[model samples]
Structures are given as structure tokens and as C-alpha cells.
Target: MPDRDPLIRVTAMPADTNPYGGVFGGWLMSQMALGAGSLASRVGKGKAVVVSATDFAFPGAMAVGDELSVYCEIAATGTTSLTITAEGIARERNGEATVKVAQGTFKFVLLDENDRPREVAL
Candidate 1:
């Protein structure tokens, strides 16, 4: 794991694996999205919805029972949107080894009560 705190952490279970028994790429992306969305909501101080996601890459792999940690940080802030960079790290189930399994960037638009895009405070 990195020196900074992770936005979210969870274990990879058998249900999250692909047919070949490796962790599914979609599952890792979903975890990254969840972490980014959480950060967006907290920083925006209101509802936030994903507008776009890009720069996804899976450079490593993890097996079932491994622990996945997603770290997110704000890359940019617009009038009504935020671009967040997310990294997924996987820790071996029975050892202290860790590796970066996935990385991506996500853009989210802050929303008001009416569900319309609103200005971000910061």
C-alpha cells in the first residue's frame, strides 16, 4: 500500500473472479469508480455523477482472497466537474507483497437537488 490512506479497501472474493479464476477487470474498475465517486461527493459536498472515465490500464493481476485498495486524488476541478485519478493496489493474501493492479481517471459533475449540474465550491 501507499503511504497515504486509501479511499476504499476490500478483499477479492471468488465471486469477483472471471471464468478463468483471475480477478475480473470490470470488478477492479468498479472499485476504482466507487472510490473516485466517494471522493467527488465529499469534495463537492453534494451529489456527484460520473461524466466520463478514461486512461484505464491494468498492468498487474490479483487472485482471489487478495486485498484491493483504491486510492483517489483530485486531478482538476472545473465549474461543475472534477477529474479524479484513481489507483488500485493489490496485496497478497498471505504475504506483505503489493502491486499496482489498475489505474484510471474519472470525471464527475456535481449535482444540485434538482439533479442539474452545479458549480463546485472548490
Candidate 2:
């Protein structure tokens, strides 16, 4: 488990399953993106838009009814961007067992009121 609290936590549902009845990787990635975006907006203190997402890896699998937690951290800060690393962990629905399911890196550019990239103030 992460020492810091998760940015977002959600339960896998039937609709979140792939055609083979297992949890879908795309859904997991979207959840991680959502969490990363939330952090970007907060850290940027305004609007932020993802300019790149890379280095995605899926090291585990999960099933419907499991719970998914997304953790994110600002890995780097640039003059006008923040690089966030995100990890997805899945816990068994009925037990405490957990596994790391996915990871990726996202770079977001802070945006000003007019939607232009702004300098990162922190």
C-alpha cells in the first residue's frame, strides 16, 4: 500500500470488464489519467492539460468486483510543466491481497486563463 493516500479509488464493475470477463486495461489507464489530471490541476493551481503520456506498463491483472486505487506524484517540475507518475493497484474484493496493476508517466502543461502555457510557479 502507498504511504500517501490514493488520488482516486474505485471499485471494478461488470461494465469495466473486457470481453474475456477480466478487468479492462483501458479502463484502468483512464482511471489513472483522471487521478493524474486531478493532481496536475491542484499542483498547477489552475488549468492543466496533458501534453504527453508515456512508459505505460501493465504488470498484473485484476477482476471485476476488485477495488482499484490510483496513486500519483509529481516526479518533476519544469518552467511550464509538471511530470506526474501514476500507479494503479488492485485489491481483492473480499480480501486484503493487493497487486500493482499498471504504471505510466504523464506530462502536463500549466495553462493560463487564455489557455496558453504558463510558467509553473512552484
Candidate 3:
């Protein structure tokens, strides 16, 4: 487990599995995006939308019933954008085993009420 608290944490349900019965990579990516977006919005003090996502890698696998925790941090900040790095860790369903399952970087642009890009608050 990480020393810091996760931005989002949830259990991998059977519905989140792929055809092979393993947790779906898309589901993991979505979880990471949710975490990154949350951080971006909080730091920007307004809406933030993903502009780009890259460097995705699945280093491990998780099964249904495992607990998934997504951790995110702002890696960089621009005038109107935030670069967030997100990592997903999976804990065994019935044990203490944990592994880094996924990681990626997401770029989010702060948006105003009209949904146009706006400068970040800080």
C-alpha cells in the first residue's frame, strides 16, 4: 500500500472483468482518469477536461473482488492545463498482497462555465 491516501478506491466487480475474466484495462484507465480529473478540478477550482492521456502501461493484473486504489498527483501545471500522473494499485481479494497494476499521465485543461479553456486559479 502507498503511504499517501488514494484519490479513488473501489472493488473490482465481476462486471468489470474482460472476456478472459481478468479486470479490464479500460476499466482501470477510466478509474485513473476519474482520479486525475478530480485532482485537476480541485486544484484548478473549476471544471477540467482531459486533453491528452499517454504513457499507459499495465504492469500487473487484478481479478474480480480485488480492491483497486487510484492515486493521482499533479506532475506539472501550465497556464490552463494540469499534467497529472495516476497509478492504480490492486490488493488481493482475501490477502495482503498488493501490486502496481496500471499507470499513466493525463493532461487536463481547466474550463470555465461556458466549457471553454480558462487559466488555472493557481
Looking at candidate 3, what is the lDDT of residue 34?
A: 97
Give the residue spans of candidate 1 off by over 4 A.
none
Query: lDDT tens digits, residues 1-122, model 1?
Result: 68999999999999999999999999999999999999999999999999899999999999999999999999999999999999999999999999999999999999999999999997
Best by TM-score: 1
lDDT, candidate 2, 66-91, per-residue tens: 99999999999999999999999999
Descending-TM-score candidate ranking: 1, 3, 2
TM-score of 2: 0.96
Collision count of model 1: 0
In candidate 2, which residue ranges exceed 4 Å CA deviation? none
Candidate 3, residues 52-91: lDDT per residue as tens digits?
A: 9999999999999999999999999999999999999999
lDDT at position 69, candidate 3: 96
